[model samples]
Target: MTDWDQTDDVGLMLKKVRGIASDRQLMFFACGCCRLVESKLPAVRYLADRFEKDAERPMSRDEKWSILSAIGSALLGDIHPILRQFLMGQDNDSWTMAAQVASIGRMFEFNGAPESLEAAGPSIPRNSASQAQVLREVVRNPDRNIEFDPRWRTDAVRGIAAAIVESRAWDRLPILADALQDAGCEDDELLQHCRLADHLHRPGCWALEYVRETPERSSPNPGDPV
Candidate 1:
């Protein structure tokens, strides 16, 4: 009974989605959260891209751990405590980690102050609002099966989706939607999601995943392509 469209509290959304969302969904959400401050911290885009690529390629547990460890190490020194908490608190579930990253982005968005969580309390609502929208885009209607016609995955559709995913050029989503239409796609939900100018479309985006034929797995493996 969560009012997804109305609720802007990402913490609430994360609680609802924790057990149900796949690793791919959570990773996508995490990247989307980090993307909130990519302009201010250009390194965020690089990290997000690295994460997305790592998620898609198949890897052993050790490999996955190593990659995350390297990333965590790279983030050390002169970083915000929230981000430090995110990387060091490995025991946290993906939902909590993503929320922490969002908090870091909120900090960068304002003053890049290394404010403690308690000190950053005043902006929690605004931070949640931004992240909740990302969670919505990645998890839109878990109960509803948005059927996509396999025939719609034509060369143009796949190419557009791949380019969008690789470049993070979400502005081209409408053009992809147009290509889908040319391929006779009539799914309103899918079409509208593509054409949503205000929506943040990251790699592993639900619509792009559909077009790229990388559906969310019940038990996703990092070695498995996203």
Candidate 2:
């Protein structure tokens, strides 16, 4: 078994994470240790373990926030109930929650798992309509700061595109197309749209066309106005 205390860097810590006991306390401790290490790999691995263990052992609000704090701005795909739990808590840290929400929203986009969103909130029915509403709120919320992490912008765009297409918001298709062309989205993100478009049976989709026509832009220009 891997030794948690001896694990110094992320690579070694990840190996230790698998060896941590399955109980909530151990999981929480591992998560805390992972955060102390301050490495993205450990944080991600810790989150993955917590998410899986959460299935059998429900985490308290404090534990949830602890995990969220460690996950800070990391790309945790899909709408996890843990995120909703964090949001509903009394932390009053809106920025952190927004970042978490944005990450979860991106996950939903990549996986197209509306069920996960439904799982987050029992009140919100698990269906395409409800999922669409949540996605719209996150994407359109001016206060949410969806673009806080530039590395995640492509994920956010892909999520928005998925929601638009999945919701059959045909009226928004042109708008999404325009955004894709102007936003200078990454190739992987554009490819996600192409796959989604094909699955939706919408041939020659605007997103795919945009991907085909536009060359990848170089690193974002700081001087360029948004």
For all candidates, the clash counts are 2, 2
Question: Tens-digit lDDT track for model 2 on 61-163?
Answer: 4665565554543333223445445555545332334333433433343343335544544332222332222222111222222222243335545566556
Best by TM-score: 1
For each candidate in turn, give its C-alpha RMSD to the true structure in angstroms. 5.0, 18.9
| TM of each candidate vs. truth | 0.71, 0.21
> Which candidate achieves the best lDDT against the true structure?
1
- Clash count for candidate 1 is 2
Model 2: lDDT of residue 47: 65
Which tens-of-lDDT digit does each residue in 59-156 have in candidate 1? Answer: 55455444444333333324565656656767644444555656555566665655675666675445357777788788866656677788999999
Error of 2 at 64 (Å): 1.2
Where's the lowest-lDDT run of ten residues in candidate 2?
136-145
Residue 191 lDDT (model 1): 92
lDDT of each: 0.68, 0.37
